[model samples]
Target: MELLNQIKENAKKANKKIVLPEGTEERTLKATEILLKEGIAQIILLGNPETVKANAASLGVCIDGATIVDPATDSNRDAYADIMVEIRKKKGLTKEKALDMLNDPLCFGPIMIKAGHADGEVAGAINATGDVLRPAFQFVKTLPGMSVVSGAFLMFLKDKTFGHEGVMVFSDCAVMPETNDKQLAEIAVATAKTAKAIVGMDPKVAMLSFSTKGSAKHDVVDKVANATKIAQEMAPEFKIDGELQLDAAIVEEVAALKAPESPVAGKANVLIFPSLEAGNIGYKLVQRLAGAQAVGPVLQGMAAPINDLSRGCSVSDIVNLVAITATQAAG
Candidate 1:
């Protein structure tokens, strides 16, 4: 939890504006009240102002410090709609359709970021992942020279000997069911950035696979190896290596035997899984079995930070992710 505390401190310094689309959602409202009290980040709640206040009052939480925007009645709705039209011109988006779309808080949140009204967004408490992400992908898109948007989790384990003082970053866990080598490379690079910016760790990335330096050969292993190469080339400044097994990535003895020549094998703090299925399974296993704290699926590689949340997330989870998003926006 020191990591989240640190993130909160960083967020306070950044003081970035972050929009919460699920303003009427209980956890989101509660988290917004806490964020407002702590001055962790500027809060923008998207909904009908009166309804948002009534919900907060009913829940005995005061969200007086937050900015409440009713997308349906805001003066900027016309401009946001026009921006949407322009962004979707090729898809033949109409102003009327864009205006109607903005009524959905999920869509309004991203459009706010796109128009510089807000720096980032956190949603998905009362929405599905696709609904939360579709507008983001359509509007915010990916960061420059990045064609992929991936999710990364900051894994904090009870045992201190593994990873960077027991904290490792795992990626593509909540998005990208499958990827080609190029997309995998982007995941690796983006995850490293996330680890550094959000977790405050110097990232030594390991492109993960079943094989350790080709001990066992397969197309999947080759994909990981190729991704490692591409990631290294694309980000020459970072220490990155791969086709490493999980043990080889974190165990010095296994790394010494399996990937002796690799700089990152024994010391990796960022793990880029070969697929979403693997990433999801690997993180959950460690979280439940090893008693590790899994903090994210922090959406990365977007032009602006727009993170998704699990519908089952707690108030603390929302607060922590908003802090992370603020830090990402700062970077």
Candidate 2:
């Protein structure tokens, strides 16, 4: 709660413009009112103004501060299309096709970010993850020198002694199904940056595996070991150590026995799972069994702070994510 509260405070100070493409969604519209009331951000809702107003009226929510932009009829549509075509010209995109895509609120939102009309975007409620991310990947793309985008979650645990004051960052938990050692290295580096930027933690990252300091032998364990080397080489300043089992990664006693020389072995607050299967299952087990509060699968490594939501997200979920997106934009 303290971490999230700090993030929200940072967001309020950032005063960024966040575009919500699902302007007509009940939860989204409802969240806009809360955001406006708190001054968390300046919001741009993409939809017909009358429909948005009527929907808000029906829902009995006031969205007075939201700038409603109808993507289909906005005067900037032509200019946005021109920017879109220019962005995708190398991919053989045409002006006519770009104009057609701008009709979609999803496409409109990212183009708005790329054109500098908005600071960040949040969507995926009532939409598939692929549909929400496709345009963002095509237009906004990954950050410079980053070939892969990953997801990280801020796991707030019940046991204060376990992590960095009961908080840890879990990565590749929501993206990247299976990655090679190099991609795994990127995930480690990216997750470390996310931990620093969002949680203000000096990330001591542990690359998790079934093995700890060559105690086990397998290709999978070898992959983690190789990735540790790669990630260490990639970011010489960050404390990255790997081929560690989960216990050794976070427990001081276990780390002392298994990886005595590792700088990050005992105090690893950032855990990078070797695969998405392990990451997803691990985070869920901690969230459900250990009763940790999982705050994100916050998408990282994007050029801009675009984010996605589960279709079943609550209004408060929308509000929290917008705050997180704004915080990321501010970072």
Candidate 3:
């Protein structure tokens, strides 16, 4: 079976509840239909009930098994507002302000997850990255022991002759435009966990840089090298190495020549790029040129399973992400 099918199967077994904040969007409604039909998860669509039903009818989509909650009029509004005010009171959030914010599904969705009303959330179809993530950061918060929230992609390639049978985790691809050594270490740890949970792999992390093992001396190389050290200290059980060039990290021949002594050099399945520029560009290049199915920019380090979708994503993308989120929530 394909990776997405495999994920959908696993998600059905998990049977989580995933919330869609962009419930009124056409793509979201369409994906909800498939998710419900397939029993992937119980779904909560956040929008006006009448509007969501009308949209579904207009789109010729059936959201029969999904629950629709109108943030503007739901009975849970008062309880959610109270929760938000309690969580953000230090930020000077008044009950009136919190109630007003709840009118936006983006804010309400994460609140549902935080309140145990939903197992996970998948949004960003029509919302900005910040619009989707800020609520998660504020309400859902980070996982214990994690200080930074990052993003990663599960890169599945058509050819299996490469790293980890052409399955790899590319980290910090959509978040943290730049990272310090500490934040990079945090990203590495979170990504290792993400790979194990979502990709079913024992993570061998490669902290990528332009240089390999002292072959160059720029501060950029030093940053990656330092992050590798910190990640090692933070997660000694993980197989990790760096300041490696991309080739030296994944190609055995190049590893033998350039980083022969490194345990993770050529066997790495988690590629931790030094910055968002490298990660974002690298994933897109592979997706466009290598025929790899880049399945995420999935958010990690949050306490609950909250994912962000590209605004350009198709209905299938939404379906896949909901399954992925269900799997994450299951774990």
The residue-by-residue lDDT of candidate 1 on 1-331, one tens digit each, is 7878989999999999999998888999999999999999999998888899999999999998899999889899999999999999999999999999999999999999999999999998889999999999999899899998898998999998878789999999998999999999999999888887777789999988889888899999999989989999999988899889988998889889998998988888888899999999999999999999888779988999999998889999999999999998998
TM per candidate: 0.98, 0.97, 0.98
The list of candidate 3 runs beyond 4 A from truth reads none
* C-alpha lDDT of residue 308 in model 1: 93
Writing each residue's lDDT as its tens digit, candidate 2 over 29-82 gives: 999999999999999999999999999999999999899999999999899999
Give RMSD (Å) of candidate 2 vs. truth. 1.1
Per residue, candidate 3 scores C-alpha lDDT tens digits across 200-240 of 88899999998999999998899999999999999998888
Q: Which pairs clash inside model 3?
A: none
Instruction: Provide the overall lDDT of each model, using Cα atoms, as 2-decimal numbers.
Output: 0.91, 0.92, 0.91
Over the full model, what C-alpha lDDT does candidate 1 score relative to the true structure? 0.91
lDDT of 2 at 68: 98
Clashes of each: 0, 0, 0
